[model samples]
Target: MSNLPQSLSLNVPFGAGPSGVVPGGAGSAPAANKDRKMASAEQLVLDLSNTELRENALLELSKKRELFQDLAPLLWNSFGTIAALLQEIVSIYPMLSPPTLNPAQSNRVCNALALLQCVASHPETRMLFLKAHIPLYLYPFLNTGSKTRPFEYLRLTSLGVIGALVKVDDTEVISFLLSTEIIPLCLRTMEMGSELSKTVATFIVQKILLDELGLDYICTTAERFFAVGRVLAHMVAVLAEQPSPRLLKHIIRCYLRLADNPRACEALRHCLPDMLRDGTFSACLREDPTTRRWLQQLLSIVGGNRVSPLQSGGGFEHMMVN
Candidate 1:
């Protein structure tokens, strides 16, 4: 233990027996002293200001897979210090770009973060991470267009951190991701990246759009889908080029959901020929009543009084009634 300031060692009752034992017992006092000494040793580790040491301790603790009861309580009590350390850990990202950590060290860091994320599941730590701008630290890697093995590991770690942050629902973090044009960045990344990256990006976009905050941000991304018809067309074109049945289905679903907005419906009408040709749409037409209804509504808006065969020319007219 380092030199203790007076504030850390002001207590005067040093020569006491075990807390519950009688003071006159021959060995009891020494036992109590030993316990106090052990406790003070643990406290000293907790109080250490060297973040690297603390990080190493946390890494070891995580590897042991021991109960967090002891450390969690202490971290909660000294939350300010823990938060400061987290901030410092996050700040190291700039210096550690393309992080120098080998696989083992990376695993240790990730496991430590996982444990901290569990500890920080409470509102206070969430707020602390937000206040410290932790998301900014993580976002850079997401934005990094690195393809090297080292950068790939950092990217994976960054994504894990993002998952942990969002799990906290730190609104500041959410707002930052939204406000900083992350959605568009993600979309572009998906547009240019490999199939796996695109899949992850699509999942992320859908997840964001499912949330109210994310939906609001998306709506604000373009003035209206009609006004950004070219961009919408580009998106449709990208989907049209893909062969994934599931992705096409999701894209159609998302378009249908967006079509509930009059402007989005109008913008989507321009792509109807391509959409109708998609195998997913053909599959749905055979099985999904909702798809039929959406197609009807879309045709009503796009074709006006012009009746399509399904609407008036066949037994399918009765299918809708049933």
Candidate 2:
């Protein structure tokens, strides 16, 4: 069964002026301005329903997303708007099967995703967005192995939606994601995505690890811990050759959080990269004291030990950070 709806309709209107407001009063002008803007936003959203107008409407809505603080609910409750966005996503599946997505298709879908991200970020509608299972629709894009500009942009924009959900420190967000394939998808991106995509994917992982339940989940099994550890090890080796302080910061924080788990810390004693321990990243950490301190805390917690199961030719051996 298709995970998305063919169409949906909700008729919550905007731009109604508050009752009992006197004309030309101090409060009236601001209310009038608010109504006009809301009306314009509503028009832009309504335009999304028209087939010919969908592309320009999506482009405009995405560009002006921040301007409409109420845009999330507006997108959700407006007639046919959310369906239009899903249709935009559905239109791209054929391209994915054939690996034929172009820049134009990628941009349009990303614009749709940007609006979905807005919905995911809003406090009022985030859980509602989750209840509708909207994030699952984005997973295929993240799962793509293509490295072209089109796929890369699609993956990054899709990550932005998940990143927005996790950005606000909510256990529900972590809980929802932990229940899905988000982690493996993120790990794959961390392994193969461009620097920026990897950074966002790592940021998502870092946020998950920061949550207590998420930490317990990842550390609940050696398999999960080593899966994450191996990828972080690979990223560290890559960063050692071509450094990115931004990406390195998230990677280190994930390690520091893992160290908070006793078993993971024990595993890290042997498998944690040598470069992280030997000041290879000192220059990179010079400007970022918080991450520098995180690295220190991780080293201190894992301590100076190199004896563990991972030491005996675990999958991480080839990623030595020399």
Q: Pick the candidate with the highest TM-score.
A: 2
Could you give candidate 1's per-residue lDDT for residues 1-322 as a string of tens digits?
3454322211322233346342546468865665555355345435434565666655555554243333433444442445644554464466355545455554544554554554445554556655655555555556666565544554554455455556544456677667665565556545555545555555555555556676555554334332233433455566555655444444445555555544344444443454544343455355656656655665565443333434343222233345
Error of 2 at 82 (Å): 1.0
Residue-level error in angstroms, candidate 2, position 128: 0.2
Question: Model 2 clash pairs?
Answer: none
Stretches > 4 Å off in candidate 1: 1-58, 61-116, 119-124, 165-173, 188-201, 221-257, 271-277, 280-322
Instruction: List the RMSD of every prediction in angstroms.
Output: 10.9, 5.6
**TM-score for all models, in order of appearance:** 0.53, 0.89
**Candidate 2: lDDT of 194?**
97
33-63 in candidate 2: lDDT tens per residue?
7666666777778778888888998999899
